[model samples]
Target: MLGAQQPASDQDRRQYQRVKVMLHGRLMLSDRTEHRCQVVDMSPGSAFFATDATAKTGERVIAYIDHIGRLEGTVARVRDDGFALELNTTPRKKAKLAAQLTWLANKHELDLPEDRRHERILPRNPSGILSLEDGRQYRCRIIDLSVSGAAVEINVRPALGTQVTLGNMRGQVVRHFEDGIAIEFAVIQRRETLQQYLS
Candidate 1:
């Protein structure tokens, strides 16, 4: 998708494929105040989010999204329920956002569960970041890793089914232990992302 000042034509806008996505996140306005939001739809250069928080059109915003990291943008349209964010990120970040949108579009197209036995292996590098959907972050250790899920050693126990990001893989709390919690990846990750992010 092309990224610049603005789409030159309707065809250019059409070329910027819009994907229906539902990612939980939070955004900070120019005042640096945060509000809970869910990204409802996204394109290469913009995103729409559902939030009770009101923002004026043309206001600058910075958002921390699940799975997809941080995005900087400005409010393009304000709706009764939410607002559209016109992204001002670099071209590379926009390209990354496009790829993430593609993945979200095909999210239900699951691959056959890899490692049917769900073997857990100790990661060579145990350091990882645990992030909640609301954007709270904590340092965590990868106690064990597998293609489908992970046992992370962190201080807090998010309620079961709470969506979270472990390393760069999106998952949810499946179980909780005394010292940490168990996470099941939202999608069975490809070997490349699994290794590249975790190992």
Candidate 2:
């Protein structure tokens, strides 16, 4: 996370465990253009991202990182605010980029981003259809999890704080953004459900 003051131009741009970079241009992935995203932070292995677009976990995209440059990433998790990107193995290129990333992270002594600052653990984002009670199945991605809450990203925008069900877990929407919902678990205990589903 960046402190209040901007780094002086003459000063080296610090690399954080997560680094925020203003997106420079529109990027295309899967016939869709993902616009207006800020890099939350990055390492050579992976970078966290915040975007206001409809995206699914495990989806891969070509992302352009400032200084470090553009590379492909796999969606790891989704949240109301945004989703996280994980690096995939590509032998030669991955090794080279990873070395570069480690250098930046060490040189900057970067702090963790807000999303990762807490001790909370979230579910690994899944790519699949969730069948609802009424026989309607929705395409959604697991966002995050806590003992009392969880979040999901769906194409439909439900009202703020609305109660919704995902699988056997039920929770209330704590926050709503352009393309996601932050739900507070109300029915299934967070630990139990995560274990069963993830296992």
Candidate 3:
């Protein structure tokens, strides 16, 4: 489902290059309602998103994409399957977006894998308990598991680089997403036994 859209002129009749991506995220409307969506195509200044929620043209939207982080924009147009957003960002943010898009483009062109070092899997039993260094524990939902890292959905977000324990595995917070943080394990996990501790 990840494929580029044909180059089209924007509302201002300016054509911007776009790359195909299948990034999942939550879309927050002006009324604060959130819905799950997938970003189908993205450019530095705009993106095409597919979602079940409907919004009128010009409606404000705040999306927290997986790798790209938060993006604020206004609905520019609606398609049968989705809508387009005209992004509102500073010059610096735009530059970052450009770089991300380029990286995605090249990765796709070269057929590179996202995580080549480890094979990631969705745990059959996704529930786990996360404990902070202070001994506080919170229930967490495992998003995905890899030999080197795991993505978990938890309410408490510790500072970056904070050491934490998920079940019996120890790791440090390396990245944050809308739903949770990504932890890179202190030691590589044996793929055969990783799922036992995660559950």
Candidate 4:
């Protein structure tokens, strides 16, 4: 829990702490392209999916969840037949998905149901880092993530509306908090920004 802390509020607590389901769905990378997929697992922060074709690491993909809704993200890693998605956008979805997950978690409470939880350990599995346009970089720990935005923790706080980049994803500093910063995801790069970083 080096960079981890309590959720900013009760609402954040309920939303971030819940375990979510990964229902089967389709992923349409291009508007005209679609592929069959099974959402093997999900969390407030990320998802693991299985598809016939493996997407290259850092490639951006657009996904549609059955009841949880849709998202846009980049491939964290690729396997022979599937891949792991480290969400570049997914905060609002977390709240919506959390409500759905709460119901499911409660349902499983009584029954001897199977656990469907997924956890992401960072640094070793680091999702992304935060950088100011001015050239300062802060190690960012994601609070909750979605295809639209993410709540991140930053040591040096910026003012509201201050634009910054996480990995290669860009957003504005929407709000400040006691232990971190909240970044609203803005322009999600269609291609994996990691390539630019490596090259």
- Model number with the top TM-score: 1
Top lDDT: which candidate number?
Answer: 3
- Candidate 3 residue-wise lDDT, 121-142, digit = tens: 8888898999997899999999
TM-score of each: 0.57, 0.39, 0.55, 0.42
In candidate 3, residue 185 scores what lDDT? 71
* Per-residue lDDT of candidate 1, residues 44-81 (tens digit): 87789899988999898888876677887778889999
- Clash pairs, model 3 backbone: none
TM-score of model 3 relative to the true fold?
0.55
**Local distance difference test values of all predictions, in order:** 0.76, 0.54, 0.79, 0.60
Each prediction's RMSD over C-alphas, in Å, is 7.7, 16.6, 12.5, 17.9
lDDT of 2 by residue, 87-136 (tens): 64344555566566565454335422112323456565554344433457
Rank the candidate models, highest TM-score first. 1, 3, 4, 2
After superposition, candidate 4 runs with Cα above 4 Å error: 1-22, 30-32, 108-199
> In model 2, what is the error at residue 187, expressed in angstroms?
50
Weakest 10 consecutive residues, lDDT, candidate 2? 4-13
**Stronger candidate by TM-score (2 vs 3):** 3
Clashes of each: 0, 4, 0, 6
Q: Any idea how many clashes model 1 has?
A: 0
**Error at 77, model 2, angstroms:** 0.8
